[model samples]
Target: MSHKIIRSLLEGRLKAWAAARSPALRIAYQNVVFSPAASETYLRAFLLPAGTNSNDLAGAHRLYTGLFQITIVAPAGGGTGAAESLADELAALFPLYDRLTKTGFSVQVMTPVEPGPEQQGDTAFALPVSFQYRADTT
Candidate 1:
């Protein structure tokens, strides 16, 4: 896919998510790990509950309501593929994809790490995500 499309979406989503966090969340990179071209790469991101808000409920509680995990393959550029660029692209594309498909989905990316020695051709990435939803009780 075009890097521009990927970059815009990823940055947009990350920015939106950071704003939602209030204190503002910076991109965390330590959790990132690169696999041999044959294995999969993984990134994990967490969305925590906002500490305070304008509206208050008597019994309101801080709830960890979401999780987004994203795994993507490296582009063919060779030297240090575009992890950040790809992450940003995914961030933006996800919300739109969810909206279009009308599904409850999330995206997450782990921090970057060194590439391992076991890599082979066609590097792979796996982003395993889990989401929870409540049924309409009305």
Candidate 2:
């Protein structure tokens, strides 16, 4: 099977998660999933498909581990706190390295990485958090 389906599933879960956060956070990132055509003035949160690693977990079935990157881009001025808050939410949601059981995948690990600026300009500031998820490609 294609890993794209797995990535798609993970992205949907992340957006659902953003919506379920504290009221302020939920509203701050109301449009949690990225829309390429949206205006630049709004805070944008989205997932990037970083690819995956695979291995045979059992006979005839392979376990695929996906590498997903989450980026929270906020306007340059007060975006730092918003970015950090979202990062915290992601970190909390994954909790070290575990599965999303109900969602059908096991998270091998999720960590806040690229501690430096991914992109910076007059209107945006970004933070990237990386995650690994493993699932059977039966």
Best by TM-score: 2
- Model 2 over residues 25-132: C-alpha lDDT tens digits? 321332455453232332343344354444555565665654666666666777477678767776776665554543464435444333335677676777776665
- Note the Cα lDDT for every prediction shown: 0.35, 0.55
lDDT of 2: 0.55
Candidate 1, position 74, lDDT = 40
Q: Which residues of candidate 2, in runs, are more than 4 Å off?
A: 22-59, 101-116
1-138: candidate 1 lDDT, tens digit per residue: 122232333446655765565444344332445344333233434432222222336534322222333333443334444455455545444533242111222222322222223223444433333222111110
Residue 80's lDDT in candidate 2: 70
In model 2, the number of clashes is 2
Please list the residue runs of candidate 1 whose C-alpha ends up more than 4 Å from where it truly belongs after superposition: 1-64, 75-77, 95-138
For each of the candidates, give the backbone clash count.
24, 2
What's the TM-score of every candidate structure?
0.26, 0.62
